[model samples]
Target: MLKNKSWWSQTIQCHMQNQKSLYIFVSVLFMMGVIFGAIIVNTLDLNQKNGLINYLGYFFRQLKENSIAEPSIAFQHAVGDYLKTVGLIWILGLSVIGIPVILILIFIKGLVIGFTVGFLVNQLSWDGLWFACVSVAPQNLLAVPALIIVSVAGISFSLLLVRNRLIQHRGTIYPQFISFSFLATGMGLLLIIAAGIEAYASPWMMKEMIPQVSWITVPNGS
Candidate 1:
């Protein structure tokens, strides 16, 4: 009886450790993707870079100039896009085969964010840096953490499914599945709030910061 108890304790500890390790590994992979994206943005040629800068500048300028702001419309669109991702994570978390795909999705999300920030800072210098901090930072403050948490939960649940199937564990998976669903639902709600912030608050912030952008001036003497 004592031996059986000891074995059970060891098994539980091992499972906990594996879950922790999985979270750390997934986070590292996402960060690596972000770094890779930054590198890609930084390596573009001057002409292409200039084009990108022009497009971004024009877009920002328009946002600043436009007096009629429709934050509700923006919120709907943002929430819809975010829900697509939330849905993917929800559906994928149940299947053991989804682990890699979910990880890839998380990485891609991080990459996009990193690329946008890196491009802004690289192209605009200090002005771009401030713009990024003001416009990008607020929404992502909610979004990035929520995404990471959902990813960790999804990956962990998928691994649990794998362990149950591979080891032929006798316990029923219904309880675990329910728990996973609840975790995902909570995370989804957080993402909705993030979408709201992105739509409503981010634009206002950008409009305020746009005036601070210093345009390059040519000297007649040159």
Candidate 2:
């Protein structure tokens, strides 16, 4: 009984430690989002903003009828995208020097998202807002969480590699690698689901919403 209690205690401690690590890594992603969001807000000019407004209006108007995409094509695109993302994570996790680079990649991803949403919100206001919510939010609900998990796992594995190599820490690399691979595989599946939603559900949702939404008029060449 005493041994069982000790084992349970150790398991709890380890679980807590893993949770803490995940939180730290996710916080890094969050900080990246904030920094990139600010950059988008600061760098966009009037012409660019106006162009974005027109583009968004046109895109949404078209979305009402033209948003249907082939499911197989969507699946392929989604799988390809997942491969690109997980490939980076896997490659970066293998190298000691890749830790910072992986973080930077995560930052760039956040930047792109922030910029896209920011532009949409700034240009169309409510129309842009609802469009983004319907079109972008659905897939991201699955994809982003999967991304964050894989990213955190990758960062942790990379840090482990760094510590084992540079800091001369005696740690098991093989098991960690297995864990990382499994995490990536699971996340890849989740991302594929996200892609399915993006291709089929998101477009459908946008098409449905587009007819109902009225775009706020933009000034000509403003």
Candidate 3:
């Protein structure tokens, strides 16, 4: 009983540490990017019930219909296309940079996410939010964390590289390697989540009476 209690305590501690670290990374992005940048972006006063929003609505509607009517190659291609964008971001962040560079990367990421969510809200009225809750939110929960991990490591490494703080021997590489490994693992997990949603949940949501749920498996028949 004592051993079991110790094990459970250790697990909780590790989980809390992980959560704290993740929160720090994500909070940095939000503080520097959206809160700072939005004042300018919103000056344009983009909002719901616009012509652009209407077009996006139509496009998403067509997407839903197509997904239900035909599960074709094009459908698979769409998932590939989105994942490619995510891969590009990871690659860029891996190159790393100083505070300015990191901020720029973070800002760019925020813009993409902000536009995506805002566009949906604009286009579909209230339903856009529901659609996003189903489609974007789940995968993003994983993907954003992975992105933050990658970006933080990249920025750290890049700063070290720029300062020529390279270790004289290979032994020092272990710590850096370990850090990158964790971040890469996070990225892989997020990609898996995204793929699962694309292959399984998204299609099923359209065809069957289901919302985009987590790890929901629909059998072949009935």
Best by TM-score: 1
Off by over 4 Å in 1: 1-18, 67-69, 214-222
- Give all TM-scores, in the order shown: 0.84, 0.80, 0.58
lDDT of 2 by residue, 23-100 (tens): 576767866784677467658788877777676666665564474457678778877987798888888878777777
| lDDT ranking, best first | 1, 2, 3
> What lDDT score is found at residue 110 in candidate 2?
73
Structure candidate 3, residue pairs in collision: none
Order of quality (TM-score): 1, 2, 3
Per-model lDDT: 0.76, 0.72, 0.53
Clash number for every model?
0, 0, 0
lDDT-better candidate, 1 vs 3: 1
Supply candidate 1's per-residue lDDT for 11.
50
Residue pairs of candidate 2 with colliding backbone atoms:
none
Instruction: Put down candidate 1 lDDT per residue, 1-222, tens digits, no spaces.
Output: 999668645754554465787767877887888788889897899999877767676676567667435889888888888778877987888788887888899889778877888898887778888888877788778777667766777777787777888777756778767766765666677788988888888888888887777463212222
Looking at candidate 1, what is the lDDT of residue 158?
A: 81
TM-score of candidate 1 on Cα atoms, chains taken together: 0.84
